[model samples]
Target: MSLVVPAAALGLVAGAGTRWLLVRLPRGAPVPVGWCEAGLAACWAAVALAVQAGRLDPRWAALLAALSWLAVAGSATDLLVRRLPNALTVPALGLVLVALVPAGSGAVQRGLAGAVLLGGAYLVVHLVSPHAMGGGDVKLAAPVGAAAAGAGWALLPVVAVGAAVASAAVALVAVVAGRAGWGSRLPHGPVLLGVALAVVAVAVPGPRIPG
Candidate 1:
């Protein structure tokens, strides 16, 4: 109960750091400093609630927080530069491995396998049509896959479907608003990371404690 405020404060600090990184990174667009700060603050608050409700394993908290940070960082970079840097994505996979260690051998195995599978699938797609998917997204997929599978493999599909649907919807809106034309590419990293975060929220839900 008491941790939520402090967690949110920590998240704001992390978000400020993220905003600083975004400003320093090569970018074609202005960074949304306020949005990033708010997003992480909200994510941390949610994490605290999940923890308080006993829905999330304390052992997995660090992984959850790290994933949240990665999502924000990757999305901002991809949207601003249309590139996902190895700077953000590669270290995320390593962090996933480090974060999942305390969850035991089975979890570590599942996380690694999930990483390979998702990363491989994206790599194949990137090879087939470089225009359709970016290298950054392929790299980003590994950590997201590992995190989802570490929680439970069933979420892999949820992440897939959610991302696809969200992407399509965003594209539709862009077209309708005349901001983009048909077949134009939108930054996909945001949709992927956003859906992954949504899945994490769903996976962590527990019965509400009656006040």
Candidate 2:
């Protein structure tokens, strides 16, 4: 309860920033301001609650917040343009790597390995069926993988499976509702980011709360 107001305030700020970024994206359609604000606020608020509940360290919380914001921005771009800019994904990967420095040697090792594994997997998929998976998604996978790995090596598989299931579910709904056809290109960045965030929230150890 004590954390709610601050969390909400942060959400407002994050939402505004996300909206501003979306508005400035090159060759991108103007995203609905209301949608951006509402989505980002809700996403950030959930992140805040997770941080509070998990009793995460300040550094880890900050990393999570930053990743959430980037994910929001990336998702918006992908949805509008069907592209995730290198401008966003490259810097995010670097930031995630740098942020993990304080987490410990083990975390750094796992993060690097996770990045390689996940990014490579995506790259392979892109090579096999470029139309099915975009380069943007391939780039975006690295930071998500790093974050998941920072949480735990085992969580990497969980993130992968969760993203696959969620994407399939959403695709099925879209087809059933006539919102999309079987050949439609779905923006997968959001799904990947969503599952990564969930895995991080669950797998990352937090400070124990005293009863």
Candidate 3:
């Protein structure tokens, strides 16, 4: 509870750093700094709140926070260039794995399993239809899936279904509005990361009031 505000403030600083980092990247550029900061702050605050509410274990906080930041980076990159750079996604796979060290053996195993599950699935899709899914998305999934599963195994299914449904809904809306045809491809990284972060950070059941 007491840590939530500080967490958000830290997020602002980190978000600004993220913006700078993005601008420096070869393919990353032109993200609005304010929006980035606000988004990261909200994500930080949500994770803090979840921790205070006991929905998230303190042991897993670092991993989840890292994943949140990665989500921001991946989303911005995907939205800007419609590509996920190996510079970001590949390194993230190792970083998140390292972040899971303190969580012990069970978490390490679960996280690895999650990575294989999600990343492999994306890879299969990419192999089947390169136009449908990109290699960057597949790489991004490994770390995101690792962190989500390390935090909560249930989040794996939640993120998959949520991202799929949300992407489908957005595509439908775009088609209906004549902005895109049924064949139009939307960037899947943002949708997947956003849902994964939300589910990992705040999807646990809230405290029940007197009924």
The best candidate in terms of TM-score = 1
Would you list the C-alpha lDDT of every candidate in the order shown? 0.79, 0.77, 0.80
What tens-digit string does per-residue lDDT give for candidate 3 at 37-76? Answer: 9878987887888778777766667777788888887888
Misplaced by over 4 Å in model 2 are 1-4, 45-54, 208-211
lDDT of 2 by residue, 104-162 (tens): 76777888898999999999999999988899899999999888887677889999889
| Candidate of highest lDDT | 3
1 or 3, greater by TM-score: 1
Q: State how far residue 98 of model 1 sits from its true place (Å).
A: 2.0
Q: Stretches of candidate 3 above 4 Å error?
A: 53-55, 202-211
Tens-digit lDDT track of model 1 for 1-211:
4788999999999888877776675543346767668878888887887788788767667767878888877887787768787767888998987777766667678789889887888899899999878888899999988987776778777886788799999999999999999999899899999898778667745433110
Ranking by lDDT: 3, 1, 2
* Pairs of residues clashing in candidate 2: none
For each candidate, C-alpha RMSD in Å?
3.8, 3.4, 4.0
lDDT for residue 178 in candidate 1, whole number 0-100: 100
